[model samples]
Target: MNTRSTSTFGHVALIVAHCAGMVDLVALPVWVGTLIQHYRLDPQQAGGLVTLFLIGAVLSSVFLASRFQRVKGRWVAAGGYAIAATCFGVLSQPLDVTTMAVLHAAGGLAAGAALSATHGTIARSANPHLKFAIVGVGLGVFAVLFLGTSPKAIAAAGGYMLFAIFGGVMLLAALVCAIGFPDPEREATDRQGAPVAAIPRAVWFGILGISAMALVQSMTFSFLERVGNDRGFSLNAITGVLVVLGFVNLLPAALAAFFEKRWSARSVLMVGPVLQALLAATIMMAPGFYAYAAAASVFAAVMIFTHTFAFGLMARLEPSGRAMAATPAMLMVGAAIGPVLGGTLVKTAGYGSLGLAALLIGSLAVLCMSRLPGHAPSSLAQEPA
Candidate 1:
């Protein structure tokens, strides 16, 4: 293939990765309500089912990251979709709670393989940061649209049918994967012909920072609705706030990209967590819906902006794609642990636990990020040309 063809393929892979990331192969809160209603699970049990999915994803991501070049990239990615599709197909059947958890865990493992492949493609891109931001925007758009539509569909079709529908979505992704990724032999030649670059020391810190960031976000996100209700907001109001967040989530790519050159990645990485913690505080302080709405909008924008830099920085940390390969694994690892922590904190600390958790977690993230470049540069004004 020529340069243009390779670039086109890479772009398609990025979009596919974005979609793979967006596809909730496991269905979180949406499935939470269904699991609770149908399976007679308590809130924590339903949430644990979500964590099971992440646990599987984390495990698979680690496994795939090591053998990324050894196998057929196309088949690995396509097969992951196929596997998730099969899991979803089985899940659509009537089953006991134990069976359902087992099936969801299977699906999560499949999703993680595809996610690692897709993120690897992004990491290998020429402009990884920009690509990462675009991927985030794509995910945000898809999440909003899916979240907006899925609730009603879950209401109408119920959980089993919805799982089947997602299975169909994965099947479509498999078709795209066939076209996007190179065949095994071609991939082997490319890997041998064009070697991946050396890794920077800073990449390791970026990895730790991204993982911690995920823990902070998921810890609160999984239980955000309960927190809102505890603060006196109605369920309908909280749903409305999320929908608005979906819309505003589109801002990250454009906003973050605009500032990335001017602001320097280091300072953005440091301050991003602080802003996230502040947003958590806003949710705690603002009891009224409108105030919460204001906070949520800004929060969505800031969170996306931060995530763009985090993923992009990791991609840039190593041209060898090792850092990027590990990206999804770290993310899922944090996500897997988040619910456990959130469950514990919400129980012990009350509605304000998310704020406290974010504060503490964000501080940890900040500390991890400080080791990277741009954090303590003299000033944007003082930099040499």
Candidate 2:
């Protein structure tokens, strides 16, 4: 294919891969709820299952990210999703908790590898921020469809259907990526025999900042449905809130794209965690249904918006794409801690403790953001690879 045609196809593949691989963002509520309601697990156990999945993702991403240039992105993206599909399919079968936990971890490993390939390719694109935002928009649309339909499907056919749906989506992504995942142009350091420059310290801070925000996001989001349910909201009402949340999700990435130049990325990064903490606090502590629903709906937007900027910044900081290749590690490391931590807080201290936790974590995120340099250093920019 011509370069233009190849780039177009790759973009589409990335979008699909993102939606499939980040299914946790949309499915966590139903996922945790199903384990609690159907499998009769407590909140802590349900959250622990999700935590195992994220921990596996973190491990896989960290391992593969460093090898990004050596490995073939297309093969990794396709094979990972293919394996993840099988794992999810097997998870649909009736199994003991131990078996199910193992499957979740395995599936997460596969999915995380695929996502590492996806983000690495995007980082090498002409405009990483714009490309990432475009993919984020695609994820938002997928979230709308998944959130709107999956709950009802699970209700009708049992919780097993949720895993079936997840398997199907991963299978489809695998097929598309196999056909069209584009090869990124190698950096000069790779083309020659020279070593790539080390990732900047600022980039590490950006990654940590984004991860902290993600921790707050998953910690609160994983329990969104249960919080409402415990507060006596009807199933339809909570589902409706989720659907609205998906729609709200549609705007943040686009807005981030528009503001990429107009707004300071560092400022956005700092403000994001504060907004997230406030929203989470409201979601956790609000007594009225409307108040809780309002906060829950906009919560994801904060992470999406901030992460878009952070992704772009890291791409600039490390032109070789290794930093961005660790996208799954940056995202899932903190995410790995969130569900279990949230569950522990809830199990011991009630939902109000989640609000307190968000405040503390958000403050840490802000501190990390504060440590970032205002821009990528000139020496790093001029350095080969």
Which of the numbered candidates is closest to the native, going by highest lDDT? 2
User: Each candidate's TM vs. the true structure?
Assistant: 0.85, 0.96
Where does candidate 2 stray beyond 4 Å? 1-6, 185-188, 377-385
Clash statistics: count for each candidate: 0, 0
lDDT of 1 by residue, 1-385 (tens): 2122235664566566557654642234455555655566765676677788888988988988766656556777788888988988898998887898898799889888887877776665555667777767776776677667765676577667668767887777777887776432122223667755555667777777877877766666666555566677765676677677777877777787677678778888899888877786677556677776777656656756876777666654554455676667887787777766766666667657677778888899899889888632232121111
Tens digits of per-residue lDDT, candidate 2, 159-263, equal 899899999999999999999988774453565677788887888888889899989989999999999999999989999999999999999999999998798
Measured with C-alpha atoms, the lDDT of residue 269 in candidate 2 is 85
RMSD of 2: 2.5
Off by over 4 Å in 1: 1-13, 24-34, 37-39, 182-199, 229-235, 298-300, 375-385
